[model samples]
Target: MTFRKLMIAGAAVALLAVGATAAMAQTSAQKALIDAAKSQGTVGEQADGYVGVRTNADAELRAAVDATNNGRRAVYARSATEAGTTTEIAAARMFETQLLARVSSGQWYRNAAGQWVQR
Candidate 1:
């Protein structure tokens, strides 16, 4: 193949690989943090398409929440772009229709009014 063509193909491959990595499921550490946070009522899903602290948390827990929520925001931003909607609308729709179902009873979550409540 021509060098220019080869470069293009290589770029495409790299892009696809990055996309695949992004599509992979969350890491074990991430899962564990989220689980612990939920159980402890330290973090929970919010109506804004991201997770947040339901109550005060230690530094480690706070960091985990921040990481997870940041990841969620990136996803929400992409979904919003694809759906031609605002990020807040996209997040609210996901929280109301899908994310809430994953939350366990007694877990803390932010309701539509942004108030924290136990699920």
Candidate 2:
């Protein structure tokens, strides 16, 4: 393979790894709360690669969502730097290729058109 092609392949692998790592970075408690909230239709994954509250959120749920988004932001920022892109682009790519794929059936996610969709 050409050196350029090899580098592109490596970067793609790294990006995928980073997305998976970010998804698993949450604490058990946070994950539990987020999962519960998602099941309840109170919160969902946003297309911009952040968590969104569909209804009024209590302190605990809100905190968990905040922590989750914070972790995602960190990952997106690092990936963006490595990829020579903006954080928003990195986040969108991660959402489309990685995070959105992990959404379970009956869970909620915001579509790119800002519509809340159930997976």
Candidate achieving the largest TM-score = 2
Each prediction's total of clashing residue pairs, residues at least 3 apart in sequence or on different chains, is: 0, 0
Model 1 scores a C-alpha lDDT of 0.68
Which RMSD values do the candidates have, in order?
A: 10.4, 3.4
List runs of model 1 lying over 4 Å from the truth.
Answer: 1-25
Candidate 2 stretches with Cα past 4 Å from truth are 1-12, 19-25
Deviation of model 1 at 36, angstroms: 1.1
The sequence of per-residue lDDT tens digits that candidate 2 reaches over residues 48-104 is: 989999888999999999989998888878877776767787777767766798788
Clashing pairs in 2: none
Q: Estimate the TM-score for candidate 2.
A: 0.82
| CA shift of 29, model 2, Å | 0.5
Clashes of 1: 0
